[model samples]
Target: MKIQRRTVNSSTDQVLDSDPVIDRIYKGRNAQSKDEFDYALAQLLPYHLLKGIDACCSWLYDAFKAQDRICIIGDYDVDGATSTTVMLKGLAGLGFTDVCYMIPNRIKDGYGLTPALVDRAISMQAQRIITVDNGIVSYQGVDYANANGVSVLITDHHMAAEKLPEAVVVNPNQLDCTFPSKTLAGVGVAYYVLIAFRAYLRDQGHDLRFNLLELIDIVALGTVADCVPLDKNNRLLVHHGLKRMRSGQVSHGIAALLSIAKRNPKLLASDDLGFAVAPRLNAAGRLDDMSIGVQCLMSDSAQEAHSYAQTLDSINLTRREIQANMLDEAQKSLETVDVKNEKIAIVYGEKWHEGIIGLVASMLKETHNIPAIAMANDSDNTILKGSCRSIPGLNIRDVLVDFDLQHPGVLIKFGGHAMAAGLSLNASRLTDFTEGMRALIQEKVTDDMLQKCILVDGPLPQSHRNLPFARLLLTKGPWGQCFEKPVFDDVFTLESVRKVGQAHLKLSVRDSEQQYDAIWFFCPESWFAVRAKQVRLIYALSINDFNGKRSVQLMVQHAQVVESLPIVS
Candidate 1:
């Protein structure tokens, strides 16, 4: 399949350039400077989604005045954990103490606000049930809460259904909302709700003494972990969060997680939060209960946080083992079937654990470079629950929605954003559903869309791989999703190569003037076919701090050997 290359002319690619002006715009830290902050704040002046915020704030203030017992129903992932933490801490700062949180267990309670969870909330005698990161599509759950005389206020950023939930939904994706930035993570929306609550308290002449900006670290952690686009608003949230984290003002859980992962807090970047911190937090939810993770975030004592961090670290190890085994099994299953011939890769196993289907789908997508879905049949019933992960330019949610429209009774329920989603169906419909999805993809996705390529910002000299250069990049970044850390292209001559840890290859690469060591994770051994030739490399700059010494490293993304025609060179 031929792929269409997306290229911008040199003169027109201003935003992607490494120039000072472009850097200032994309870095988003200039918001800390008075002049730049004022200028940027002026651009946000026309946004008026604060009206719904005002309504949400009024409702919360009334609940506070009446001394209502509030229960927060949070999702189990990092975004949900951070969102729950932000709300718990934010409300406590507003002098509201009658608050408790419940994170749904991934295995038992499933995702979001289920009827079972709503019943649990009622059993706890909660007057109000506030949802973080979830509850946007939980129509039946919200109805159960309403029937039980419980009010619900939902703060989320997931894609909404055509028929909204019967609750005070405050998602920016709501049809009525006109917020300029629509790319907020669940934590970002939760923070905004708190901002509105703070504004309401100020209007009522109340003193709120907590620093709201301190929660930016949580927001940054979740936003990057969830892979949300970092627009202006999200960028602001992450920038401030990265600042506080680097300044040593982040939660003890985060600090301990970083410590356990051997990541240096002094020079942490956004990737550290996404890859190092968020996964450990999510491991608890994936393997056991998420309460362990939420407790880790909410704990103030370093000792308690360290204990939870250790538990989470242990869980992450177990999760790695589980995922490795599952991926191997899934790949073996793929080999028996003709996955290469299928337009949409849909594979299922009765023995596949539901908790790891999302990871399996991600692996399939990476392996085949196609839209992939994986399901695990429920042990008790004929129902199967699945998760999906998509490539760029493909909207998995929209595709599912289209599928639902075309084939009724096939999808029991599904909801999510453009790139990822979750769904359920009867086990009987699996074959037809797979065929329908493949036909849909073959009709929609062109041949050119299948090949994946690395996007390099520009070329960098080998001399830049040093401590001083690494420090400069680190200080200049609070980088995440869209405004990513710099990836450069270079031509390197390979000196030596050997497989490390089974699949990864460790290489000693030399350019014209300097040599550097690099590692490519999960690369195939066949890539060493042109070991002695110059190869083009795409990589991100990183600092490897080991045993108190730091050095810049190239985290390789992609590489291809530059071949010469016979006798043409």
Candidate 2:
């Protein structure tokens, strides 16, 4: 494994902050100017810049004027749920009375706007179907909807195909979309549609007082949960969303979920939404019905929201159990298989829960530092559904796209971001598909792409490793995905070490007699090699509060044994 230090970009230091540490961080992260650092909403790009937005808004305006039944077809994920809720609230607030939403079942209905989902929407009397976070790839489904006399509007943010569905598509990543930031999550696109639609309504002399910022928390949650890159526009959305959440102006559902997750809304951060709140909401979609999650997100009252949050939390616990069992089984199987010659890890279980396979794939990717895919039987047991996670430099989605092009009929359906994707095939073709994937991956694989490496922001100065700096680090950026929080590396002598929880390691480390508590959550196997010696630690600064007192803590990222220095007494 390689440990590399980040180099600051000099050109980005024009609008440097007062603190040198902050300036270093800003420059290192390529922050160019004051506007970028401030994250001002005014700095966000105009919604009009998005291609097809005008036509998209035209469809919504038509639906509004005609009083058509509008049913939102949403994907069964956090982004989809938030987008659906945002649309429901935004359209209803804009005086569209007959708006409703339906999230596809992860297990039974499959992903995106399936013909089955469209039929269900038509049954709901939908004259216009607006798809949120999906529908970009639903050619057959859109045809079915159109054939049924249902007009469809697609608002998605996934990588687009050369040919689009026969519907108005508003995706930043689409071929002709000149929108500057192509990294908007599905919810981000939905939010933008609402923005444009509201503007269109106001231009038509409707004095709608709906503030789009009211849904920023949901937008932030979806953006972070989807793990999209935090480009300028997305950062503007997320920064303000965190600001609103921290100020107690968040939605009842978000607040309730945070409360149930034991996260303080007053101190809400991006990770809180990503790891805590989003997972609980997603659990409902993964294990049960996404309608539960969508209802929770759109609940009218605190009591109702809390009830749903509790239920989702219970589902999340069950999901964790299922995930742990599946991961354990996969790990045990991999122990016997030599992965040295393999460029990708593909594992399958006949009885594995399809909903939990994505999480299992993510774990395997991190552990093996290679692309991983976990497959399970579809509800009918005749097809296999797989979720993929990839390492850096390997665009898994593109690989799937190219593979499907090269070997037609191997992949049933596939779509997603570069780092992650989903695909399915006939259960009978598992062996053929596996070989195709490995061969295709080998054609594109490089030794550098397969190498395990960790990047950090060099060393944290001994003088700057105090509580105040730690708190400052914690509050700096609501960081996730592409805009990662700074991780610093340094060598420290071990003072004490102990195992905590089930899989966590709690320890104390010293730098010249100054001791600090640290925790390695989901500690790797390498810790067992360096736990008793002086070690080079890669960690993010964190604050641990106990009984109203806060102290600096090291949230370990990686640790390796190093020779001891004689600087300490």
Candidate 3:
């Protein structure tokens, strides 16, 4: 991948009171005023702006007053786990009794609030059912619940279907809902619901002043993990959550997961939550059951949460091994694929783990810079569960929707966000679906979408590359998705390099004047054969707080050889 500097934003000269580089970064991202950079809770949009929030809260009030059985149905990803924990923990804190939850099994119950799952919730004596991270397309499930006299409320963030479900829906993407930020994660929606309900109770002469901000940590984790665009509202949610974590006010489960992942909460940022903690939580769902993850997050005791974290870490290890093996098999299969003309990569393994295909699909997308689909035979052996991952400039979900409409019965069912989606089809129709998807994508995806380029913020000034500047960059904002963290490129003379940590390399390098410590994680085997004396590094500056001392450190993301020395015998 070639390095490309981002275009400078010339609309405004000064929008922030901080450093010039930070100002430029903000302006380039289209920040027009200081308010867009604000991360305060007071800046969050009001819940009343959501179309169905009042009705949803009113229904919740009735459930709380009657002490009716409330069953929350959650998905199996990190967002789902955290959303379930937020609603369960939040409502229970608000003095609601007999609240329970149900997470569908990936192998059995499938995605969303299925009719079978609704019947199970009914059998559990649930009077109300609330779905987190899903249920927008679950028309049959909502119909079944409505027919059975069980009230259903869906708080989702996915794009809406043409017709609505027969439930109290609070999705910001609803046709007429005027919520300002449409990119909320499922956990963010769940948080808003409880916040609105809490306010409603207070207005009804009942002072149930539940600490709403206490759930920000879970909200932050889910928001970052879901990979939603970090708009202004989401930045506020994550900013306060990171603040609480840094101050040691965090959930037992998250803290334990951080400990196991070996991340320092003092130096934590959004990527740590996404890379270290999110995968551990997601592994529970991929391998066995995600309830293990939700229980971990909701655990009251530190010891218990740590135990669950250990189990999750183990499952993650197994997941990694399975993914690596599957990728190897998939890559071998790709050897015969027509790389020049292929628009979508479709790979399948009969014995592959259904849940792990999503991970493989993501890795393939990153490695190939193309949309990828990984399919695995379902337990029934007649069906294939497929996971789709796409690059920017292409919405994979839209592709699936078009494919489903243009040629029906090829897909058993499909739903998801723009960049990622999940689908199932008959094992016999794999070739037909793959070819059809490729043909459709051939006409839709552009050549620019297939190219991989590394975007950087030009070169970092030598004067500003210091401990204080690095510290400010880390804590000044919680960045992700649409709002990106900054990385810069510069040439450096390599003094020495050696292996450290797990599959990592630590380097001592210097620019023209100053020396800095740098590290690269999961270094490729090709690095061992490097005889390069100088290289251009694309890196992020960070803080090293080891042994109670602080200094600037370089976290290298990509490196290209600029000068190579002769191989000495």
Predicted structure with the largest TM-score when compared to the true one: 3
Choose 2 or 3, whichever is better by lDDT. 3
TM-score of model 3 vs. true structure = 0.96
10 residues in a row with least lDDT, candidate 2: 524-533
Question: Between 1 and 2, whose TM-score is larger?
Answer: 2
Backbone steric clashes in candidate 1, count: 0
Q: Rank the candidates by lDDT, best first.
A: 3, 2, 1
Off by over 4 Å in 2: 12-15, 405-408, 525-533, 564-569
Which stretches of candidate 3 lie above 4 Å from their native place? Answer: 499-503, 545-550
As for TM-score, the candidate ahead, 2 or 3, is: 3
Which candidate model has the greater TM-score, 1 or 3?
3
Clashing pairs for model 2 are: none
Top-lDDT candidate index = 3
For candidate 3, write residues 264-369 as lDDT tens digits.
Answer: 9988999999999999999989889999999999999999999999999999999999999999999999999975478778899999999899999998888788
- Predicted structure 2: lDDT: 0.87
